[model samples]
Target chain A: MRIEAGRASRRYWQDLWTYRELLGFLAWRDLSVRYKQTALGVAWAVIRPAFTMLVFIAFRKLAALPPSGVPDAILVLSAVLPWQLFSTAFSEVSGCLVGNANLISKVYFPRFLVPLAAMATSVIDFMVTLAMLALVMAWFGYAPTDKVVMLPLFVVLAACLALGAGVFFAALNVQFRDFRYVVPFVVQAGLFVSPVAFTLGDVPEAWRWLVALNPVTGIIEGFRWCLLGANAPFYPLATLTSVAITLAMFALGVWYFRRTERGFADVI
Target chain B: MSDIVIRAENLGKKYRISHETAQPYRTFRETLAKGFQRRRGSAHQEEEFWALRGVDFEIRRGDVVGVIGRNGAGKSTLLKILSRITEPTTGYVDLNGRVASLLEVGTGFHPELTGRENVYLNGSILGMRREEVRRKFDEIVSFAEVERFIDMPVKRYSSGMYMRLAFSVAAHLEPEILIVDEVLAVGDSAFQKKCLGRMEEVSAGGRTVLFVSHNLGTLLSICDKGILLDAGGCVANGNIRSVVKAYQQKAGSGEDLAPNLIGGPLKSVTFRQVWINGEKLGGSQFSPGEPIQIRVVGNAAEHLPEAVFTLSLYAEGGRLFTVEDRPMTLHQGEFSLQVEIPAGLLRPGDYSLALGARTAAELATPHDWCWGTDLASFELNEVWSANCKRDLHGMINVNARFTRENAPILERAAT
Candidate 1:
């Protein structure tokens, strides 16, 4: 490999692929260490979506909102799982770089793998909740239509959206510690702002497009529609907007991350 | 030629030091505040400092090269550039094969993970593939001597066991060109010897190695070539002996020598000066069996209770001995202390001294003391020693009396 002035090697991507096993190791380390001594262990993953489902149900009842034709339990859960995935992954990725300061400063690998691997723990947690969602659907006797095949695509979309913003903030957090404060606030506010607990239709007709500007909105809405079928019809224009914004953010995040990648070790 | 495995052309790394900010990273509010302050006509105090500049070198496929320098001489920057941990600001380095750097051991070892899990984790972090770690799993465990506790979390292991485990994984890394920092400074003497032996085997196997260490003896023994860096520039590069000689000369004389106050003073006690035999040491060389007198002068900012001064001697790869002076009370003023090492106490070898001062309250934390390692060094020349003909096996100098099996007790006692 040739290391040039102000640039990495010509085979940077190849270098990343050569170190692919590191991703698995790092991911495994995080997952195993996360719940090592905790009483609940992997059960912690199920608790969040279940708790969020209960809270949303109580919220809908208190507000006396009109429910879509689908059962409230499945509607809130299907959306909550994806939202949980995005938020948890987003926060994890943003903090991964700072958390592994010793590794970044001492060793050389594709630095992005640290944040990318961070997504795995959240993905595992999402899978746990996905299994819980299946159990809930079985309890409510609500199976999906053929549209369920599209579920993986929306999951990918949610992952891309999380990774994009997470990578961007991860780089930003290295330079300006203020981003640490910014990330949790955005993730928390994102739940109410996006259509996780409430459908995009709940917003006024004119503001639906604005609500869809949040990349997670389109992903959550699309995910819910896949699970609930005709009962949870999503606005096509909003989904397109969400997809566009997610892709754009992914591009912007990667561009910014690469641009600032070299300085990470020095500053961090 | 294809035999040349690593080459660098005019490599340099520059860092922008901002006097306005004391920390490496800046808060967003501080950045905004700086912008506003700049608009108010205050000048910015940013200076460009080159950590490594115009360093050019090449290494053949099997050369074992040592990088030697004092503090802030940019040895680390050069290694970091070669290791690809950081990019240089000017020029480039072309590495012919896979390069792995052990800047520190256990780079990514999680304390919460078991020893078995950490080996895999650390192995992959050091750039080994999973299959490679799996293949060497038993070897690493046996080398670390933690086979029985492999499933136990590392936090529960003794400090020696932890360091051994960490270094074992690193020792097994088989990159074509390996770059290592001073990771051997930890662990016991036996373990350090084992590590050095493994390194020698690596060099013998025809893989290129670049090592950085403060132990000159280890460097002279392991490396045939050396690069000496001074003030961010390569001053000497060639045969190991000559480069080390140049480094010694640079560190020994002129304005850089004597009474070296490294990194300024610490806490309330400011080390003002140091002297050897009533003269500034300046890295002087002394004959073996010669008494070395060292004097330390310092001033306390306030009344200090039970302040202890210590001087430690290090040789070969370990600290041989440490002597602590009596705890004395100082009433906020300058004071001088003298330590005399009588003749016949030191062998014919090179040794470094570490000076430390701490109060009783800070005794528990070793890092909290005002200390410096290799602060001022002296060499005991064998050629000039009276006991040069005697064969010595240990680090210290001690005389032995041998008696015949039938020797009379009265004759032995009279002698």
Candidate 2:
């Protein structure tokens, strides 16, 4: 192996690809350890979004809010699936670097793998939540149109947005621990603002564009459109904006992560 | 000649040494206060410390190189730079073929994971491919001798078992170059011996190995070449014997004679120097059945009404044998203490002396007034005499007198 200093060295990405097996092992370790001691086991993954869906359903019923013409449970579950994935990915990825300080300080691998593998656990949890969403749709006697085939693309888009935000925060979290406190607030606040409980149509027409800035806003709505059928509004411009924002954040996140990657061992 | 497997030229690593203690996750209030302090020009100053500087070396294939240094002597920094855990501030190193570094055993082993899982995890962390780990899995499991509990979580394993499992995985790693740092210090002596045997086997297989350790005997025995680091620079690089000898000489030179004063000067007393047989002690070697006199010199800023001076002798394995603890009142200014050891009291082995002083006021508390650890070291060798031979059994020597029962009395031997 040839070792060199500086950020522009070409071996970094190649090293990442070379160490792909480590990424899989780390992700497996995280998934196995996550539910090891808990009584609920993997049920905790579904319990979180299930509880949130119920609370949102009650709130919608009490407020007598105008329904988006889809079953409230199905609507809430579809949006919650993608939103939970984003939130979990964000939180887990942001803390991954610091959480695995022992591995980072002692070993040589692409530092990006830590956060990327951590995000993999969140992806597994997203899969479990997706299964629960399918069951919820079945219980409500809702049949998805052929548009549901696009659900995977929306999930990928959400993952991209989460990973971008995660990589950015994971790197920042190492330098300034203040992000440890900042990330939770962002995740919690993001849940309310990203249209998880209600559709984007519930918001005023002028403010809909503002909501599109949340990167996940387009993803969650796209999920509702795909699963809840064509009646669910698909704002082409808003989705484009969200996709652009997600890609930009991902680019910036990867750039910032790589830029600061070398100093991680020293600072962390 | 074998190919040069590793070559490092002018490698330097600079670290920012902050005067303040490192705290993880500082609260916003502290950060804000520090920011304000920085704006007002009262920020804590940081100095650039070069952990490694201009370190140049080459190791050919199949070379077992030992790295020797005192603490903070950049031994670990060089290993870290070589392992690529940390980048050098300047220069570069060319390493041929796959490189695996075992900076510490079980680098990524999760406590909750089973022994089998951890073995694979640790192997991959050390740069082994999954297929390779699988092929070597049974060998690792058998070598670790934890087959019965392979499925059990490692948290349930004894520390020795954990270390063995971790070391076995690392040892089985077939990387062309292996960099190990002080891992043999763990585990019991038997396990340590096993690890040494494994390392010897690896070197015999004609692979490059870079070993960093404080155990000079083991390092000298296993390695053909040695690199000595002192203050972030390569001081000696040659055959293991001479480099180890130079390192030993440097360590024994009494350059750090002044006792590290604990707390502040106001507490009470501080040790200045220790002497043996009217000469300043500097880790000198001695022989068994020899009389020795030790003198401790120190300063007492204020009169100590009730001070207890204690001298402790420690064996190589850190077994403490208190030689003396005398209570004496010391007036202000310099004070000297003398202790005598009789002949045949110490066996043939290495020992260290620790000096400490405590006051009556602090006797009930746990803290000591002033203390110095490893102040001096001396080795005792076995010597033969006309009448009797030196004993070579244990750390202590006992002079026993015997008389025959129900028989004619024998003449006493000359003293």
Please name the candidate that would achieve the greatest DockQ relative to the true structure: 1
**lDDT: worst 10-residue window of model 1 chain A:** A4-13
Among incorrect, acceptable, medium and high, the docking class of model 2 is medium
Chain B, candidate 1: TM?
Answer: 0.80
lDDT of 1 by residue, A150-267 (tens): 9999999989989999999999999999999999999889999978668887788889878888888888889988989888886788789878988999999999999999989899
DockQ of each: 0.79, 0.58
Model 2 Cα lDDT, one tens digit per residue, B1-415: 4599999999999988766657634445666777899899984666789999999999999999999987799999899888888889988998897888999989999999999999888888888889999999999999888999999999999998999999999889877899999898778867777888999999999999999986655775689999999999999998986786677567656543544423333366887777766656545667665777888888898887777887877664344477546567789999988898887787665566777777764457654466655566565654644333323355566778897689777799999
For candidate 1, give the docking quality class from DockQ: medium
Predicted structure with the largest lDDT when compared to the true one: 1
Off by over 4 Å in 2: A7-9, B24-44, B255-415
Give the Å error, residue B8, model 1.
2.5
Number of clashing pairs per prediction, in order: 0, 0
- Residue A246 lDDT, candidate 1, scale 0-100: 88
Model 1 pairs in collision: none
The whole-model lDDT of each prediction reads: 0.85, 0.83
